[model samples]
Target: MADTVFFVTKASGKQEAFDLGKLQHSLKRAGAPPSAMPEIEEAVQKMLYPGISTREIYRKAFSLLRKASPHMAARYKLKKAIMELGPSGFPFEKYVGKLLDFEGYDTQVGKIVQGHCVPHEIDVIALKDEQHFMIECKYHSEQNRKCDVKIPLYIHARFLDVEKMWQQRPGHDHKFHQGWIVTNTRFTDAAIQYGNCAGLRLISWNYPRKESLKKRIDRSGLHPLTCLTTLTKKEKQQLLDQGLVLCRELHRDLNQLRSVGVSEARLKKVEQEVRLLCEPESPIL
Candidate 1:
């Protein structure tokens, strides 16, 4: 018999396989007749890939399921996006929750509240002993810039809706404490000031990076964002907000490298180091 290959997602591992049994079980429990299981199983097991991203798996799986049942497919996408955006996955809420815990706050990761205010599903709430913290966390990497401004708009919306959420509880506005907009990249100092004054606490947390993914993408020579020039006015602004992540390897590297006078001996040492890097590995006695 030929060796069987399993489809895998990068979010999990290269050898991971899609859970056909779980899918079949869910379908059965949800009143999807037993006869439908075989087709779903066949469809799932056939999704083969050497390495696939979580997002790509989401896209592919939904596409497969949507062909047969569009409603369940739509529901699945919403649930997946929610989990990805929440504290367990994305950096914004993840970092915020960790920081709060470090600061002696009792924090609950994700608490879903259905309201006209949050069509986006849920907002991460934190309780610092007695005070409550309502954080509208949005994460945007250099790949997508839309969050830079959309985040501010979300803050405004939340502020406007706060009273409505608490109107029934009688002078309980303090129950919803501070608002935080946590992000990976830094913002203009001016934007920071504006956000603070507007009652939206912008927490720009810089993440440590090793290699530059931008340089990697650039080196690939793929004009992936070529047609981005034709983006609409709003879209262009959104695109500009996305900043590339480059190395900040050593804070001390810069201070230590200041105004060095290179001698002939130093030059030889540098060349020797380069040659050592080029040499093949050896088994030492």
Candidate 2:
């Protein structure tokens, strides 16, 4: 419904990064009733993006329960089942623990001083040695070639909220240490720039340069967009699945135009035009 085109990681071909086992573990830790696990897990499998973050998955799980129709046994009891399945009732608290131990910022995800806005449903808030660090982890599509702008925006929202709150309240002026925005997909330029301006650490999907992303695209058995600049937003979102990685893939796909070796000079010119876009500083946003 909301732009059906989902950017995915090329490596695993998933729309979002999500771990069902971890979610199960989280639900248990949250003290959820034992009966709800099956129901929630079922909903997860049916509706959630496997590559989506733990928090988002939980949000969807709860949202499902809230809207569950009571008439149909399967649909009606589903939400109740999830609520009764685990020991820890709400998964949010458990996820907070996960965020605390995330990527070396253990126990430091809270306000630096006083007067900072209190966190709401966030993972963890550690206040130690006067430095405040807030870390939020986003589960994203595990695919290596898609694009997403939400993760960064989420992080930015947290940081800006803290900054604004601190500015308004003067007693402690914690100075909001840093915000961590980590995800499995590429970030838009606006997300990065806004994060930089706010001193937020924007960590996008990063893989060892074992091989160029371009190489992966060339090998994938899929049609490529030869004319990216001309593509509509929807077309571009589709192309973001593999088109942005490399033009070689495009050239290879377009070569099919010459199945019998017929040359379309116009296609060649378009390819050359698109080539200029591969530059590092291109305005991808």
The number of clashing residue pairs in each candidate reads: 0, 38
Model 2 misplaced stretches (Cα beyond 4 Å): 1-119, 144-147, 166-171, 174-176, 205-285
Model 2 lDDT tens row, 143-168:
34333456566667766676566557
Worst 10 residues of 1 by lDDT: 243-252
Per-residue alpha-carbon lDDT of candidate 1 for residues 50-74, written as tens digits (9 for 90 to 100): 5545466546555655555543343
True-structure RMSD, every candidate: 21.9, 21.6
After superposition, the stretches of candidate 1 with alpha carbons farther than 4 Å from their true spots are: 1-92, 115-120, 143-147, 170-176, 206-285
